[model samples]
Target: MFAVDTSPRSRTRQYSTSSSSSTRSMAQRDSMDIDSAALLDIQRALDIARNTEGDLDHSVEKYLEEQLTGVWNRLESRPNTYVLSKDEFAIFNYFVGRYQDSKVAEKAIARFWSSYQDTGSS
Candidate 1:
Protein backbone atom coordinates (compact mmCIF):
# COMPACT_ATOMS: atom_id res chain seq x y z
CA MET A 1 0.00 0.00 0.00
CA PHE A 2 1.14 3.54 -0.81
CA ALA A 3 0.78 6.48 1.59
CA VAL A 4 0.45 10.15 0.86
CA ASP A 5 1.73 12.95 3.07
CA THR A 6 -0.12 16.23 3.44
CA SER A 7 2.51 18.05 5.45
CA PRO A 8 4.45 21.05 4.21
CA ARG A 9 7.73 19.16 4.03
CA SER A 10 7.38 15.47 3.28
CA ARG A 11 10.69 13.72 2.91
CA THR A 12 9.52 10.39 1.53
CA ARG A 13 8.35 10.06 -2.05
CA GLN A 14 7.92 7.26 -4.57
CA TYR A 15 8.97 7.77 -8.16
CA SER A 16 7.86 5.46 -10.93
CA THR A 17 10.56 3.88 -13.06
CA SER A 18 8.64 4.82 -16.17
CA SER A 19 8.57 8.45 -15.08
CA SER A 20 12.36 8.53 -14.60
CA SER A 21 12.88 6.80 -17.91
CA SER A 22 10.70 9.34 -19.68
CA THR A 23 12.67 12.20 -18.19
CA ARG A 24 15.89 10.62 -19.36
CA SER A 25 14.40 10.11 -22.79
CA MET A 26 13.38 13.73 -23.00
CA ALA A 27 16.87 14.92 -22.09
CA GLN A 28 18.36 12.60 -24.72
CA ARG A 29 15.96 13.97 -27.31
CA ASP A 30 16.99 17.53 -26.53
CA SER A 31 20.68 16.62 -26.89
CA MET A 32 20.03 14.90 -30.20
CA ASP A 33 18.19 17.95 -31.49
CA ILE A 34 21.15 20.17 -30.70
CA ASP A 35 23.53 17.70 -32.36
CA SER A 36 21.35 17.50 -35.47
CA ALA A 37 21.23 21.27 -35.80
CA ALA A 38 24.99 21.50 -35.42
CA LEU A 39 25.46 18.87 -38.12
CA LEU A 40 23.26 20.83 -40.53
CA ASP A 41 25.26 23.98 -39.87
CA ILE A 42 28.51 22.12 -40.51
CA GLN A 43 27.10 20.72 -43.76
CA ARG A 44 26.26 24.21 -44.91
CA ALA A 45 29.83 25.28 -44.23
CA LEU A 46 31.13 22.24 -46.13
CA ASP A 47 28.95 23.14 -49.12
CA ILE A 48 30.40 26.62 -49.03
CA ALA A 49 33.86 25.13 -48.97
CA ARG A 50 33.10 22.90 -51.98
CA ASN A 51 31.71 25.70 -54.13
CA THR A 52 34.89 27.77 -54.07
CA GLU A 53 37.78 26.18 -55.92
CA GLY A 54 41.11 27.88 -55.27
CA ASP A 55 43.86 27.95 -52.69
CA LEU A 56 42.49 26.12 -49.62
CA ASP A 57 43.69 28.82 -47.27
CA HIS A 58 41.97 31.54 -49.28
CA SER A 59 38.77 29.53 -49.46
CA VAL A 60 38.74 28.93 -45.71
CA GLU A 61 39.47 32.59 -45.11
CA LYS A 62 36.51 33.62 -47.22
CA TYR A 63 34.24 31.10 -45.56
CA LEU A 64 35.24 32.16 -42.07
CA GLU A 65 34.85 35.83 -43.02
CA GLU A 66 31.32 35.24 -44.26
CA GLN A 67 30.39 33.35 -41.12
CA LEU A 68 31.92 36.04 -38.95
CA THR A 69 30.00 38.70 -40.85
CA GLY A 70 26.73 36.92 -40.30
CA VAL A 71 27.49 36.46 -36.61
CA TRP A 72 28.50 40.09 -36.32
CA ASN A 73 25.24 41.32 -37.81
CA ARG A 74 23.26 39.12 -35.49
CA LEU A 75 25.27 40.35 -32.52
CA GLU A 76 24.68 43.96 -33.54
CA SER A 77 20.96 43.36 -33.39
CA ARG A 78 20.99 41.11 -30.29
CA PRO A 79 23.76 41.76 -27.83
CA ASN A 80 23.22 38.51 -25.91
CA THR A 81 23.10 36.25 -28.91
CA TYR A 82 25.20 33.11 -29.11
CA VAL A 83 26.58 32.91 -32.62
CA LEU A 84 26.88 29.13 -32.67
CA SER A 85 26.70 26.09 -30.45
CA LYS A 86 29.73 24.25 -29.11
CA ASP A 87 29.31 21.43 -31.63
CA GLU A 88 29.11 23.83 -34.55
CA PHE A 89 32.11 25.69 -33.21
CA ALA A 90 34.04 22.44 -33.01
CA ILE A 91 33.41 21.71 -36.67
CA PHE A 92 34.41 25.25 -37.58
CA ASN A 93 37.61 24.83 -35.63
CA TYR A 94 38.35 21.62 -37.49
CA PHE A 95 38.05 23.40 -40.83
CA VAL A 96 40.08 26.35 -39.62
CA GLY A 97 42.86 24.08 -38.45
CA ARG A 98 42.86 22.22 -41.74
CA TYR A 99 43.22 25.17 -44.13
CA GLN A 100 44.05 28.25 -42.07
CA ASP A 101 47.47 29.67 -42.80
CA SER A 102 46.70 33.20 -41.69
CA LYS A 103 47.14 33.93 -37.98
CA VAL A 104 44.73 36.86 -38.07
CA ALA A 105 41.80 34.73 -39.14
CA GLU A 106 42.71 32.15 -36.55
CA LYS A 107 42.82 34.74 -33.77
CA ALA A 108 39.50 36.28 -34.78
CA ILE A 109 37.66 32.98 -34.80
CA ALA A 110 39.28 31.93 -31.55
CA ARG A 111 38.26 35.19 -29.93
CA PHE A 112 34.69 34.78 -31.12
CA TRP A 113 34.57 31.21 -29.83
CA SER A 114 35.84 32.30 -26.43
CA SER A 115 33.26 35.05 -26.14
CA TYR A 116 30.50 32.68 -27.17
CA GLN A 117 31.53 30.31 -24.40
CA ASP A 118 31.69 33.10 -21.89
CA THR A 119 28.12 34.13 -22.64
CA GLY A 120 26.87 30.90 -20.92
CA SER A 121 24.16 30.74 -23.50
CA SER A 122 22.54 28.12 -25.61
Candidate 2:
Protein backbone atom coordinates (compact mmCIF):
# COMPACT_ATOMS: atom_id res chain seq x y z
CA MET A 1 0.00 0.00 0.00
CA PHE A 2 1.21 3.45 -0.78
CA ALA A 3 0.50 6.45 1.45
CA VAL A 4 0.65 10.17 0.66
CA ASP A 5 0.95 12.99 3.14
CA THR A 6 -0.63 16.40 2.74
CA SER A 7 0.06 19.28 5.08
CA PRO A 8 -0.66 22.99 5.31
CA ARG A 9 2.30 25.37 5.10
CA SER A 10 2.62 28.63 7.03
CA ARG A 11 2.31 31.77 4.91
CA THR A 12 2.80 34.52 7.48
CA ARG A 13 6.18 35.69 6.21
CA GLN A 14 5.31 35.48 2.53
CA TYR A 15 2.02 37.23 2.99
CA SER A 16 3.50 40.10 4.98
CA THR A 17 6.22 40.78 2.44
CA SER A 18 3.84 40.75 -0.52
CA SER A 19 1.25 42.89 1.28
CA SER A 20 3.77 45.50 2.38
CA SER A 21 5.33 45.77 -1.06
CA SER A 22 1.97 46.29 -2.71
CA THR A 23 0.96 48.88 -0.11
CA ARG A 24 4.15 50.81 -0.66
CA SER A 25 3.57 50.86 -4.40
CA MET A 26 0.03 52.09 -3.93
CA ALA A 27 1.18 54.87 -1.63
CA GLN A 28 3.80 56.02 -4.07
CA ARG A 29 1.38 56.19 -6.95
CA ASP A 30 -1.29 57.93 -4.88
CA SER A 31 1.02 60.58 -3.42
CA MET A 32 2.72 62.05 -6.46
CA ASP A 33 3.18 65.75 -5.61
CA ILE A 34 5.62 68.10 -7.36
CA ASP A 35 5.38 71.07 -4.93
CA SER A 36 4.02 73.57 -7.41
CA ALA A 37 0.46 74.74 -7.97
CA ALA A 38 0.93 74.95 -11.72
CA LEU A 39 2.46 71.48 -11.84
CA LEU A 40 -0.41 70.12 -9.80
CA ASP A 41 -2.88 71.80 -12.10
CA ILE A 42 -1.15 70.28 -15.11
CA GLN A 43 -1.31 66.88 -13.48
CA ARG A 44 -5.03 67.30 -12.90
CA ALA A 45 -5.54 68.26 -16.51
CA LEU A 46 -3.61 65.21 -17.65
CA ASP A 47 -5.66 62.98 -15.38
CA ILE A 48 -8.84 64.42 -16.82
CA ALA A 49 -7.58 63.89 -20.32
CA ARG A 50 -6.60 60.30 -19.66
CA ASN A 51 -9.87 59.46 -17.95
CA THR A 52 -12.40 61.25 -20.13
CA GLU A 53 -11.03 61.44 -23.61
CA GLY A 54 -10.88 58.40 -25.85
CA ASP A 55 -8.49 60.14 -28.19
CA LEU A 56 -5.26 60.24 -26.26
CA ASP A 57 -3.27 62.64 -28.42
CA HIS A 58 -6.04 65.13 -29.08
CA SER A 59 -7.35 65.07 -25.55
CA VAL A 60 -3.94 65.64 -24.02
CA GLU A 61 -3.23 68.64 -26.20
CA LYS A 62 -6.66 70.20 -25.81
CA TYR A 63 -6.89 69.69 -22.07
CA LEU A 64 -3.35 70.90 -21.45
CA GLU A 65 -3.97 73.98 -23.58
CA GLU A 66 -7.17 74.82 -21.80
CA GLN A 67 -6.01 74.15 -18.25
CA LEU A 68 -2.58 75.78 -18.56
CA THR A 69 -3.70 79.01 -20.17
CA GLY A 70 -4.28 80.82 -16.90
CA VAL A 71 -1.21 79.30 -15.35
CA TRP A 72 0.99 80.50 -18.21
CA ASN A 73 -0.50 83.98 -18.01
CA ARG A 74 0.08 84.13 -14.27
CA LEU A 75 3.67 83.03 -14.68
CA GLU A 76 4.21 85.63 -17.35
CA SER A 77 2.59 88.42 -15.37
CA ARG A 78 4.42 87.73 -12.09
CA PRO A 79 7.63 86.13 -13.21
CA ASN A 80 9.33 86.90 -9.92
CA THR A 81 6.43 85.59 -7.88
CA TYR A 82 5.96 82.43 -9.97
CA VAL A 83 9.50 81.65 -10.93
CA LEU A 84 10.07 78.32 -12.58
CA SER A 85 13.02 76.77 -10.88
CA LYS A 86 15.18 74.34 -12.83
CA ASP A 87 13.30 71.42 -11.34
CA GLU A 88 9.98 73.09 -12.01
CA PHE A 89 10.93 73.76 -15.62
CA ALA A 90 12.00 70.16 -16.05
CA ILE A 91 8.71 68.93 -14.64
CA PHE A 92 6.73 71.31 -16.84
CA ASN A 93 8.68 70.35 -19.92
CA TYR A 94 8.26 66.69 -19.12
CA PHE A 95 4.50 67.02 -18.99
CA VAL A 96 4.29 69.06 -22.14
CA GLY A 97 6.44 66.58 -24.03
CA ARG A 98 4.40 63.69 -22.72
CA TYR A 99 1.22 65.32 -24.01
CA GLN A 100 2.46 66.72 -27.31
CA ASP A 101 5.29 66.60 -29.79
CA SER A 102 8.67 67.26 -28.26
CA LYS A 103 9.62 69.77 -30.90
CA VAL A 104 6.45 71.76 -30.51
CA ALA A 105 6.66 71.61 -26.73
CA GLU A 106 10.25 72.87 -26.91
CA LYS A 107 9.19 75.82 -29.00
CA ALA A 108 6.36 76.64 -26.62
CA ILE A 109 8.71 76.44 -23.67
CA ALA A 110 11.12 78.76 -25.40
CA ARG A 111 8.41 81.32 -25.93
CA PHE A 112 7.17 81.04 -22.37
CA TRP A 113 10.67 81.47 -20.99
CA SER A 114 11.23 84.44 -23.24
CA SER A 115 8.31 86.11 -21.55
CA TYR A 116 10.15 85.78 -18.21
CA GLN A 117 13.23 87.44 -19.69
CA ASP A 118 11.12 90.19 -21.25
CA THR A 119 9.63 90.87 -17.82
CA GLY A 120 13.13 91.17 -16.33
CA SER A 121 12.50 88.38 -13.87
CA SER A 122 14.01 85.04 -13.18
Candidate 3:
Protein backbone atom coordinates (compact mmCIF):
# COMPACT_ATOMS: atom_id res chain seq x y z
CA MET A 1 0.00 0.00 0.00
CA PHE A 2 1.14 3.57 -0.79
CA ALA A 3 1.18 6.09 2.02
CA VAL A 4 1.23 9.89 2.16
CA ASP A 5 3.52 11.91 4.46
CA THR A 6 1.73 14.82 6.22
CA SER A 7 4.16 16.01 8.85
CA PRO A 8 4.13 19.57 10.26
CA ARG A 9 7.94 19.65 10.20
CA SER A 10 7.99 18.85 6.50
CA ARG A 11 5.61 21.74 5.70
CA THR A 12 7.67 24.15 7.81
CA ARG A 13 10.85 23.05 6.07
CA GLN A 14 9.33 23.62 2.64
CA TYR A 15 8.15 27.13 3.63
CA SER A 16 11.60 28.02 4.96
CA THR A 17 13.26 26.90 1.76
CA SER A 18 10.91 28.97 -0.38
CA SER A 19 11.35 32.03 1.85
CA SER A 20 15.13 31.82 1.70
CA SER A 21 15.10 31.52 -2.08
CA SER A 22 12.93 34.60 -2.44
CA THR A 23 15.16 36.60 -0.11
CA ARG A 24 18.22 35.64 -2.14
CA SER A 25 16.52 36.70 -5.37
CA MET A 26 15.54 40.05 -3.87
CA ALA A 27 19.07 40.66 -2.67
CA GLN A 28 20.50 39.88 -6.07
CA ARG A 29 18.13 42.34 -7.72
CA ASP A 30 18.97 45.03 -5.17
CA SER A 31 22.69 44.67 -5.90
CA MET A 32 22.43 44.79 -9.64
CA ASP A 33 24.83 47.10 -11.51
CA ILE A 34 23.91 50.59 -12.72
CA ASP A 35 22.23 50.67 -16.11
CA SER A 36 24.21 52.02 -19.04
CA ALA A 37 21.50 54.51 -20.02
CA ALA A 38 21.51 55.96 -16.53
CA LEU A 39 25.28 56.30 -16.63
CA LEU A 40 25.08 58.11 -19.95
CA ASP A 41 22.49 60.53 -18.57
CA ILE A 42 24.71 61.29 -15.59
CA GLN A 43 27.71 61.81 -17.84
CA ARG A 44 25.73 64.17 -20.00
CA ALA A 45 24.62 66.19 -17.00
CA LEU A 46 28.19 66.38 -15.74
CA ASP A 47 29.41 67.47 -19.14
CA ILE A 48 26.87 70.29 -19.24
CA ALA A 49 27.91 71.46 -15.79
CA ARG A 50 31.61 71.21 -16.64
CA ASN A 51 31.22 73.19 -19.84
CA THR A 52 29.14 76.00 -18.35
CA GLU A 53 30.99 79.30 -17.74
CA GLY A 54 29.59 82.32 -15.98
CA ASP A 55 29.39 84.14 -12.65
CA LEU A 56 29.22 82.49 -9.24
CA ASP A 57 25.46 81.99 -9.24
CA HIS A 58 25.56 80.39 -12.66
CA SER A 59 28.34 78.06 -11.66
CA VAL A 60 26.67 77.06 -8.41
CA GLU A 61 23.42 76.35 -10.21
CA LYS A 62 25.23 74.23 -12.73
CA TYR A 63 27.16 72.37 -10.07
CA LEU A 64 24.09 71.72 -7.96
CA GLU A 65 22.20 70.52 -11.02
CA GLU A 66 24.94 68.03 -11.75
CA GLN A 67 25.16 66.93 -8.13
CA LEU A 68 21.41 66.36 -7.97
CA THR A 69 21.61 64.30 -11.14
CA GLY A 70 24.41 62.24 -9.60
CA VAL A 71 22.38 61.53 -6.49
CA TRP A 72 19.43 60.44 -8.61
CA ASN A 73 21.68 58.21 -10.68
CA ARG A 74 23.07 56.55 -7.58
CA LEU A 75 19.57 55.93 -6.27
CA GLU A 76 18.60 54.45 -9.62
CA SER A 77 21.69 52.23 -9.64
CA ARG A 78 20.65 50.67 -6.35
CA PRO A 79 16.89 50.80 -6.28
CA ASN A 80 16.72 49.17 -2.86
CA THR A 81 19.39 51.42 -1.36
CA TYR A 82 19.00 55.07 -0.48
CA VAL A 83 21.66 57.41 -1.74
CA LEU A 84 20.86 59.99 0.94
CA SER A 85 19.19 59.31 4.21
CA LYS A 86 16.50 61.60 5.58
CA ASP A 87 18.94 63.55 7.70
CA GLU A 88 21.34 63.91 4.81
CA PHE A 89 18.54 65.09 2.58
CA ALA A 90 17.51 67.71 5.10
CA ILE A 91 21.05 68.97 5.43
CA PHE A 92 21.57 69.06 1.67
CA ASN A 93 18.33 70.90 1.10
CA TYR A 94 19.15 73.45 3.75
CA PHE A 95 22.51 74.07 2.20
CA VAL A 96 21.07 74.38 -1.26
CA GLY A 97 18.44 76.82 -0.08
CA ARG A 98 20.86 78.99 1.86
CA TYR A 99 23.82 78.85 -0.46
CA GLN A 100 23.20 79.84 -4.04
CA ASP A 101 26.61 81.36 -4.82
CA SER A 102 29.98 80.04 -5.95
CA LYS A 103 31.67 80.49 -2.59
CA VAL A 104 28.90 78.54 -0.93
CA ALA A 105 29.24 75.82 -3.52
CA GLU A 106 32.94 75.52 -2.72
CA LYS A 107 32.24 75.24 0.99
CA ALA A 108 29.49 72.73 0.37
CA ILE A 109 31.79 70.59 -1.76
CA ALA A 110 34.44 70.68 0.97
CA ARG A 111 31.86 69.69 3.55
CA PHE A 112 30.69 66.89 1.30
CA TRP A 113 34.23 65.55 0.98
CA SER A 114 34.72 65.71 4.74
CA SER A 115 31.44 63.90 5.33
CA TYR A 116 32.38 61.28 2.73
CA GLN A 117 35.66 60.65 4.54
CA ASP A 118 33.89 60.30 7.85
CA THR A 119 31.42 57.79 6.46
CA GLY A 120 34.02 55.91 4.47
CA SER A 121 36.32 55.44 7.46
CA SER A 122 33.55 54.04 9.59
Candidate 4:
Protein backbone atom coordinates (compact mmCIF):
# COMPACT_ATOMS: atom_id res chain seq x y z
CA MET A 1 0.00 0.00 0.00
CA PHE A 2 1.23 3.57 -0.81
CA ALA A 3 0.15 6.84 0.80
CA VAL A 4 0.28 10.40 -0.64
CA ASP A 5 0.83 13.28 1.71
CA THR A 6 0.12 17.03 1.12
CA SER A 7 1.65 19.74 3.32
CA PRO A 8 1.91 23.58 3.42
CA ARG A 9 5.74 23.29 3.26
CA SER A 10 5.84 22.68 -0.47
CA ARG A 11 3.38 25.50 -1.19
CA THR A 12 5.24 27.97 1.05
CA ARG A 13 8.55 27.26 -0.61
CA GLN A 14 7.11 27.67 -4.08
CA TYR A 15 5.38 30.91 -3.12
CA SER A 16 8.57 32.40 -1.67
CA THR A 17 10.64 31.60 -4.75
CA SER A 18 8.02 32.96 -7.13
CA SER A 19 7.57 36.16 -5.12
CA SER A 20 11.31 36.85 -4.97
CA SER A 21 11.72 36.29 -8.70
CA SER A 22 8.74 38.47 -9.48
CA THR A 23 10.12 41.30 -7.40
CA ARG A 24 13.49 41.06 -9.11
CA SER A 25 11.89 41.09 -12.53
CA MET A 26 9.76 44.11 -11.62
CA ALA A 27 12.81 46.05 -10.42
CA GLN A 28 14.69 45.29 -13.62
CA ARG A 29 11.75 46.40 -15.72
CA ASP A 30 11.38 49.62 -13.79
CA SER A 31 15.05 50.48 -14.29
CA MET A 32 14.81 49.83 -18.01
CA ASP A 33 11.65 51.94 -18.26
CA ILE A 34 13.30 54.87 -16.52
CA ASP A 35 16.30 54.70 -18.86
CA SER A 36 14.10 54.61 -21.93
CA ALA A 37 12.05 57.58 -20.74
CA ALA A 38 15.17 59.63 -20.04
CA LEU A 39 16.55 58.92 -23.49
CA LEU A 40 13.24 59.90 -25.06
CA ASP A 41 13.17 63.20 -23.18
CA ILE A 42 16.69 64.03 -24.30
CA GLN A 43 15.81 63.19 -27.88
CA ARG A 44 12.75 65.38 -27.76
CA ALA A 45 14.64 68.34 -26.33
CA LEU A 46 17.32 67.97 -29.01
CA ASP A 47 14.71 67.79 -31.73
CA ILE A 48 13.04 70.99 -30.53
CA ALA A 49 16.36 72.76 -30.30
CA ARG A 50 17.35 71.56 -33.74
CA ASN A 51 14.03 72.58 -35.24
CA THR A 52 14.39 76.03 -33.71
CA GLU A 53 17.68 76.44 -35.62
CA GLY A 54 19.69 76.26 -32.42
CA ASP A 55 22.83 75.09 -34.17
CA LEU A 56 25.71 76.66 -32.28
CA ASP A 57 27.79 78.41 -34.95
CA HIS A 58 25.14 79.09 -37.57
CA SER A 59 22.69 80.59 -35.11
CA VAL A 60 25.10 82.01 -32.56
CA GLU A 61 24.69 85.58 -33.68
CA LYS A 62 20.94 85.39 -33.77
CA TYR A 63 20.75 83.38 -30.57
CA LEU A 64 22.95 85.88 -28.81
CA GLU A 65 20.98 88.79 -30.15
CA GLU A 66 17.56 87.36 -29.34
CA GLN A 67 17.82 84.85 -26.53
CA LEU A 68 20.43 86.74 -24.59
CA THR A 69 18.51 89.95 -24.97
CA GLY A 70 15.35 88.31 -23.78
CA VAL A 71 17.14 86.77 -20.83
CA TRP A 72 18.73 90.08 -19.85
CA ASN A 73 15.46 91.86 -20.17
CA ARG A 74 13.69 89.36 -17.97
CA LEU A 75 16.42 89.52 -15.37
CA GLU A 76 16.38 93.29 -15.39
CA SER A 77 12.63 93.35 -15.05
CA ARG A 78 12.63 90.79 -12.30
CA PRO A 79 15.37 92.61 -10.35
CA ASN A 80 15.54 89.74 -7.89
CA THR A 81 16.23 86.97 -10.38
CA TYR A 82 18.42 84.22 -9.08
CA VAL A 83 22.10 84.36 -9.83
CA LEU A 84 23.61 81.91 -12.30
CA SER A 85 23.44 78.36 -11.11
CA LYS A 86 26.58 76.21 -10.99
CA ASP A 87 26.05 74.65 -14.37
CA GLU A 88 25.38 78.01 -16.00
CA PHE A 89 28.48 79.44 -14.42
CA ALA A 90 30.50 76.48 -15.58
CA ILE A 91 29.28 76.90 -19.15
CA PHE A 92 30.02 80.63 -19.04
CA ASN A 93 33.50 80.01 -17.67
CA TYR A 94 34.17 77.30 -20.22
CA PHE A 95 33.38 79.61 -23.12
CA VAL A 96 35.33 82.44 -21.59
CA GLY A 97 38.33 80.25 -20.87
CA ARG A 98 38.29 78.26 -24.10
CA TYR A 99 38.19 81.17 -26.53
CA GLN A 100 39.42 84.65 -26.03
CA ASP A 101 37.30 85.84 -28.91
CA SER A 102 33.52 85.51 -28.69
CA LYS A 103 33.38 84.71 -32.40
CA VAL A 104 35.83 81.86 -31.98
CA ALA A 105 33.85 80.48 -29.08
CA GLU A 106 30.67 80.62 -31.12
CA LYS A 107 32.29 78.65 -33.95
CA ALA A 108 33.80 76.08 -31.58
CA ILE A 109 30.50 75.56 -29.76
CA ALA A 110 28.80 74.99 -33.11
CA ARG A 111 31.45 72.47 -34.20
CA PHE A 112 31.16 70.72 -30.86
CA TRP A 113 27.40 70.43 -31.23
CA SER A 114 27.71 68.99 -34.74
CA SER A 115 30.41 66.51 -33.73
CA TYR A 116 28.41 65.39 -30.72
CA GLN A 117 25.43 64.46 -32.88
CA ASP A 118 27.65 62.78 -35.47
CA THR A 119 29.29 60.56 -32.87
CA GLY A 120 26.08 59.84 -31.00
CA SER A 121 24.14 58.85 -34.13
CA SER A 122 26.78 56.33 -35.04
- Best-fitting candidate, scored by TM-score: 2
Model 1 Cα RMSD, Å? 19.6
Kindly report which residue stretches of model 4 are placed more than 4 angstroms away from their true locations once superposed. Answer: 1-58, 85-122
TM-score of 1: 0.27
| Candidate 3 Cα RMSD (Å) | 21.9
Residues 1-122, candidate 3: write the lDDT tens digits: 11122324211100001122342333222222223222222233333334434322233344445556544444445434333533334335534644466454444445555665677898
Q: What's model 3's overall lDDT?
A: 0.38
Give per-residue CA lDDT, model 2, range 12-37, as digits (tens).
Answer: 11100112234233222322322222
Model 1 alpha-carbon drift over 4 Å, by segment: 1-56, 81-83, 87-122
Pairs that collide, model 2: none
Q: Could you tell me every candidate's TM-score relative to the true structure? A: 0.27, 0.28, 0.27, 0.23
CA-lDDT, candidates in order: 0.42, 0.41, 0.38, 0.33
* Candidate structures ordered by TM-score, highest first: 2, 1, 3, 4
Better of 1 and 2 by lDDT: 1
Summed over model 1, clashes come to 0
Which parts of model 2 have CA positions greater than 4 angstroms off? 1-41, 44-55, 83-91, 95-122
Worst 10 residues of 4 by lDDT: 10-19
Q: Can you give the lDDT of residue 26 in candidate 4? A: 34
- Model 1: residue 102 alpha-carbon error in angstroms: 23
Report clash pairs, candidate 4: none
